[model samples]
Target: MFPAEQTLQLRALDPEDNRIETSAGIFVVEGSAFDEGLEAVAIDSWGTSSCALDAYSAGDVADLGDGETFTLNADGTYIWQGDDDQISGRAQRFFFTATIPPDFTLSNYDQVLLDEKNSEGMAKAFFNTLTVVIPATIILILIAAFAAYALAWMKFPGRALLVATVVGLLVVPLQLALIPLLTFHVGAMELLTSVMGTVDEDSKLTSVNWFGNWFGMSEGEKIAGKGYFGAWLAHTGFGLPLAIYLLRHYMVGLPRDIIENASVDGATEFQIFTKIILPLSFPALASFAIFQFLWTWNDLLVALVFLIDSSGNTTVMTKQIVELLGTRGGDWEILATSAFVSIAVPLLVFFMMQKYLVRGLLAGSVK
Candidate 1:
């Protein structure tokens, strides 16, 4: 089978067949009629060549001979299968001086992305991650920009303490916040549901199901549940420290004279911030946006704790890949395909926004 089209031949060995010889391995064909149709078996190994023994069972292979050559046991045992009990004793042992040919196929990727049976397909997880990441990043940027601007320019009691507290929160490991935040989310939801429960049918609050409608809930859908809203808030809390720190530092560097001049020209603080500071601070915002986007996109722990519900509807890419590891760990092809799909979006995002990232970091660090 080395040439793929070659016919198998069986021939009587020379009288010297009893002698121990060095040659490309041996083939022992065991069907009762195997010897009738086969002629002399000659393995041509004289030339420098590489081949694979595609027929070797796990332990059948013993050793590799010198370069471009191999050896096999010249003696072979043939079992005659006379009964159903003998089926397990039958095997064809073939040793060939060959190497495994490389096989490349796109079927792995096709299965991972296109096959719905493949753990509900990665497409669902891709969208779930995007849903969690985009809103979380946007919310964090909007909230953090306000907080950072206020910290940079606004004066008030305990301002230094607030900045220090935000900076201090950055050092706190996210692991510590996991359980407490989850409890808080669950408790808060329970409280909201309880409050809504007390409202009568005729109450103005219940007239339009404002809470449910605000959360985009469908008919009979409860407001207390795992979804994008909670995940967005969780990520915002985790990301705010760094976001505020970076934007606050960057905004602080803007020329004070411009702010003073704008104030002198009858521009309100809100107008100056909207018209001047926000545009000027874009590099910082974009930088944090990329960071938060990538972080939230690749996140697994937070999603697992906050977003993934009991019904498994909201799994993200990281969790999806982990599930692949658990279920198809032996399937390397599937694993590779899933992993590649999971990382592709982040890689695309990073490359596309790399300029802003570099500019943002350098801009903050330098001035």
Candidate 2:
């Protein structure tokens, strides 16, 4: 249905086999006749210099008698002549519509399935992130709440030093601990496997080959330095300190009067935390969830160092998008669609939790 036009003066033709050759000039064809099945076509100027159209099918260049009236089988056009027209010496251009075949199926089913599978992979990545985030959030909130309560109230010795140590650790860069942590993880995994008698004395369990036989993954598809468990543990460890610190700050700000009243009611510290503090800390919890979810969802470096394999079974959305760029970079539509797919889940999580992030949730409970 797409319409187009091309206009050029008649030029000389060069006899180069069966293909019609055009001179170094421009030609324009404006007609309702455009067929996609046509084969080879060429345009030439009055001089012997000629050029052939870039696109030519086998059936397009069939002999149409004396060559003055040749039939174009396709809707798409090609430019035979270069920028300079030999006859006119002016800029030359060729334009034609891309003909869609009557029987040609526009819908590519295989491509659709490929797209669906990619989407499924993205969903899996989101699920994996959630697996990491939810447990980490709950643990962090509980520990931070207890620490904050103790630092603010419980009259414990060395409270200031403990709080100071937590605050100091916040400034420590995570990158510094990468090597030591990886080594520890490898050693710990091996130690556990040995104690469980999972490996024989002759069959040593190297970190690189650990997941190979266990998960039945090929060498290229292996998570060489760190396995899935290692990545999960790494995420937990890296997230724990900051989580405890921030949550402690928020929980420490709670009013002391509530705690005292709960105590007067014969409530234990655990009872107060379970019944009162947790419900009151929803806003802070939600805020931290947003941060952690966003960080973990978009994380490529951590996933790359820990999760990806050569066969791409463990590969996450970020790595898949990068690989897509290398393979399908020219396809703008696919690239945009895939990028949006990667971000969709994180956006949904943020919107879902935004209501709990209201500032006044803790107002009445606190001073």
Candidate 3:
């Protein structure tokens, strides 16, 4: 017996003998049938005041009995039976034949899963970018401010040439010197190791069991050979030329009268720069910072050249996004999400610094 929410159980008979048994209540059957074995049975309701049996057969079926009993001679059919003659319908069921193209397969589900994973990886990449951004910004601003003041106001031999040389370097594309620079970095690291009495026969920095403790490094972790420090140096080096050039121009453009007046009041160069020049050059410094922040934030080639293979330990956001795209191109959703995440930091930097960008630090320089 079967109710609306309950299922009916039925036993299968052999292919030749199709026997249907109906109890006193409604019965429902749902199952497939074999070619030489029992066929699928369908029983919606039976023996009720309003009962109907809709039978769907694949082939010509020999109804062995009336509403009470049904049989199939050859092919299989779905049969729905009802009592009290309230509803009765019979239909033939046919086997469906689908032709799949030779090249096509089910791939939508896999693509969706891959896209989700890529999106997560992209988020991690954004975090890495922040790690690079915050420290690099602070370092650049400090170094640039000091250098700018020295070149602009403080008199020294070769100061003009030094400023000109740094500006001239802006013409040299970074791609041209990438390899040479990396080689120099590697060699310098080795030299530092040798000077510190830590070089091994293979020229690698020897592990110092005690120094790690002093520096709070793990017992076996390599502290100085290559790592975050190396990356920071590379970023600072690449960022220095433009930073120095822009900042020098802005600082040099500060009011000469202000400096002369500060000097007349018995102010030292350090005091003048710290108290007068710095406060006045904030706009120029902020502008240069925005430029450097964006360039370094979106940098992929530099990261690849310097920090490749530093995946889990030191991989940046750019590298992470690139890897995700290469591995999961089919995942459009993930790609879009990753793209937006990567841009979010630069966007914030620009929006935050935009207010001060309009001021001209050179306003009172000439006068």
Candidate 4:
């Protein structure tokens, strides 16, 4: 468009002779302005079109339709004998088109699986999901293990009420707590920052922020309850009810004599939990681990509320896949590839932890 009125024309012939007409290239580099469609394939391997007039013998001419013929000079100038002005020495950007044969008539795995932006690959989201899930699962299991041991064996004030509350929470929907928990996370962070961090001239706290208008999006925007740690805590809270309940059931089934002997031998609660109870509860731990991992890995709503920020740095796989489907809805082959890629980890976890699945699910049924 540098010439304003004159236009660059382009066409392509695929390897299968599919003449492609919808293609153009915008040269942002110094080499050429006569290439949008031509180098899109070069930049990202998305072969939009193949120019029809690219082949020529050493001393022979290739006919460019419309009475045009191009020459490649020794200095690499594209000299053309056509009605339009020559583009051999321009430094400005312009659009160009050609009809060379395309390198591919059909795309392979490379095109669908790998790209510059990784639109279909979803790599960023995949690893972000792992970041959220693994630590969250660990924290859930550790806390639940101790609480389950206390609820099952030790007597304390309101212990029965705690058990009843946990059982009642099993039937409560997690969605109901989202807003309140988000508020609590923000309030706690604000309190911590007020105590531990100084206020600057800009009125921003110097502490690691949870939810504040750091981006200047608005005076009221929140950021605290939407990060990895927040996601970890959210998943942990949402998962704790089942984890504690299930673990308590399993721990209750453990031999009474073993725990009694450990106590009689002067074993502290912590010692008993680590040395005696943990080894005996491996199956239950893994069973809860499988549940927590699977839930956190596939979760979208909690991630959206608790993990994802405007920066998209903490996007999980489900959210990323939703984006892929929305943006590339036309590419069914790529969509299929993405589907397979997304489910791979969950499937592997299921198969690897299948043995513990039954034990965990049926923990308290018989007793």
Candidate 5:
């Protein structure tokens, strides 16, 4: 349907049916569609020092060859990489129109794994899963390493009780702690904001809240005042039990003379732990890291409760896969391919570190 109001105009080109104009304005005269939409170039904004992205938004004129321009628009958010700093990102134009593809190949990968609106948004979700899994794995490992070293080598008050408690927690279901932990996480953030924040009334968040973007978890990034920080702590809490139990057993198995001789040389416990224990306990650390990484990577429950909001900015792969299954459940090809996309990373991770995994699993696995 050409514009009914405006007089139709066309170039002198012949066979106008397949020649959709790619330049200026989208125009369709009589029996053919010759139209132009928008064009956006994504020059990489990534700087050398950091992942400073050169982001661009697609122009609003985007539309399929529907003979109607400006009628289809969608939010196209794509996140590439994320560290404690800002995430690498890009935006695409998601235009929707009802039309058949010229041909159907293996496109389930596209349909199930892509799209800004209903598709799983696997690209962002993959990086988002990384954002949660990597940090959570690192945090839990470091904390557990310290706790394990102290428990194994140092004699402190309540040492036995602490070990017992960690062991006890290993049996506790993480489900039991989710609600309580989220409540506490939210409360603590609010308390901090109230105490040490410059409130920005327009956004209803402190202009500069805790850590103040030093770690890149600013107030604006929070959903219900919880985002990566909350998710990190949540994963850390659940993982600490197993992390400590495994590491402590492994640390205790370290040679007594090495630790005693290090202390005899007047080396501090911190030095011993860093220089001696860390190097020696690499396998145990790696094994726990693998387990922790896999747990957080595949976890939908913790991600939903602690990280993701209605905005879907912080969604992880597991949740995204669930959305795909829910929305495109009938499409078996899509479900199959989507399942592959979900496991690819974990499989790669497992294979890469599998040798250490075996050593971690067997080395003084229990006290």
Candidate 6:
């Protein structure tokens, strides 16, 4: 409901009589489509009000009681004095009070999902973000777990220095590497595709179609192009430092006797890591998985740099939301709907992994 201070006011009423009134505009009371209330409507001579009036009609003006006010019709038209009077002016700005009810409907989601022509739609971008996040999270977590386990348990020279270096990487700001990494990915991908193209026609590598298919190419094409692979590698590189640091600390605190006992029983290093340390470090792994998934899922800059190319077929949810801002600037319905859709995944992941997040935070903090 509009406050009394901001409510539309009838500043002036010309010829407040029954004579042949010229340019007479009468206001009417009408129910708003948005809410159940009496909305005040009036026209401003200065045209400073945001509302615009279309036409005027001729009818008896409604009487206003103590707290009552007049509202314009939905079309912003009302009847004035008589047939001779014609309301025509340059500064005829229409003003109206609007009350909105607290309600929600699934139509917005339906439109966002089903409207393919909507460049701002979340359907394709949502899946594209998933493609970037799922593989990136899984690959990075696996690689980081192995590195963290090695740092925690392996007896090697300069091990402490290596641990220090990994921990130090956590302090490095990711922004510094943005330009360099993008440059590297672009250059490296060109070289990689060139080499792939130069491969022999009858080579056994080409016989395996996995490499070609992964890059959105055919075996005959034999070229690795820009796609989810580059984005996955970029996220892995950025996420590895934190993943290793967190998992290493948690792995080091596990029962040392259990690992030693596994070794005494003639278990291989891989076995002990897979069968013992991996299970015990679930909290840390889940914590990092949530972090990396949410980060990669919500990333716009990295996706723009590595994943999305000139085609824009692989745009992620974040980038799609940004495009919405430009095209649908005034449409708050589409903007708000797209925003919530982008955030929905992160919210779901947080709620599901909250226990592990708390456990990871508390794990190495205590003695």
Residue-pair clashes per prediction, in order, are: 9, 26, 8, 18, 3, 5
Q: Mind giving the per-residue lDDT tens digits that candidate 4 earns over 44-115?
A: 011112342223422233344555444332222233333322222332221232223334333424543576
lDDT of 2 at 300: 76
Query: In model 6, what lDDT does residue 267 have?
Result: 98
Model 3 lowest lDDT segment of ten: 45-54
Model 5 local distance difference test score: 0.66
- The global Cα lDDT (0 to 1) of model 4 is 0.65
User: Model 2, range 171-289, lDDT digits (tens) per residue?
Assistant: 87778877788887777766654443335453343333554456554322322455567676666667766777766777777777898899999999889887887787778777776
Pairs clashing within candidate 5: 21-35, 26-36, 45-54
- Candidate 3 structure quality by residue, lDDT tens digits, 1-367: 1111112223333322332335664332323334334333333322211122223222323243344333332223334433423112332222321122233333433442355865455555666667776777779888978987898888889998998889888898888887888788888876655554455667654554454345454422332444555566778877888888888877776679989998999999889878998898888888877877888888878767766554454667877755655542434444555566667778887888887765643444555
* Lowest-sum lDDT 10-residue window in model 6: 84-93
On residues 133-211, what C-alpha lDDT tens digit does candidate 6 reach at each position? 9999999999999999999999999999999999899988888887788777767765665444344533313433454
**Best by lDDT, which number?**
6
Q: What is the alpha-carbon lDDT of model 3 when measured against the actual structure?
A: 0.60
Output the worst ten-in-a-row residue range by lDDT, candidate 5.
Answer: 1-10
Ranking by TM-score: 1, 6, 5, 4, 3, 2
Q: Alpha carbon lDDT of residue 210, candidate 5?
A: 56
Model 1 lDDT, residue 71, Cα: 26
lDDT of 1 at 362: 90
Which candidate model has the greater TM-score, 2 or 3? 3
What order do candidates take by lDDT, descending? 6, 1, 5, 4, 3, 2
Whole-model lDDT per candidate: 0.67, 0.55, 0.60, 0.65, 0.66, 0.67
Cα displacement (angstroms), candidate 4, residue 167, comes to 0.7
Scored by TM-score, the top model is 1
Segments in model 2 whose C-alpha atoms lie over 4 Å from true places: 1-120, 123-126, 201-225, 328-333, 360-367
Off by over 4 Å in 6: 1-107, 119-121, 198-225, 326-328
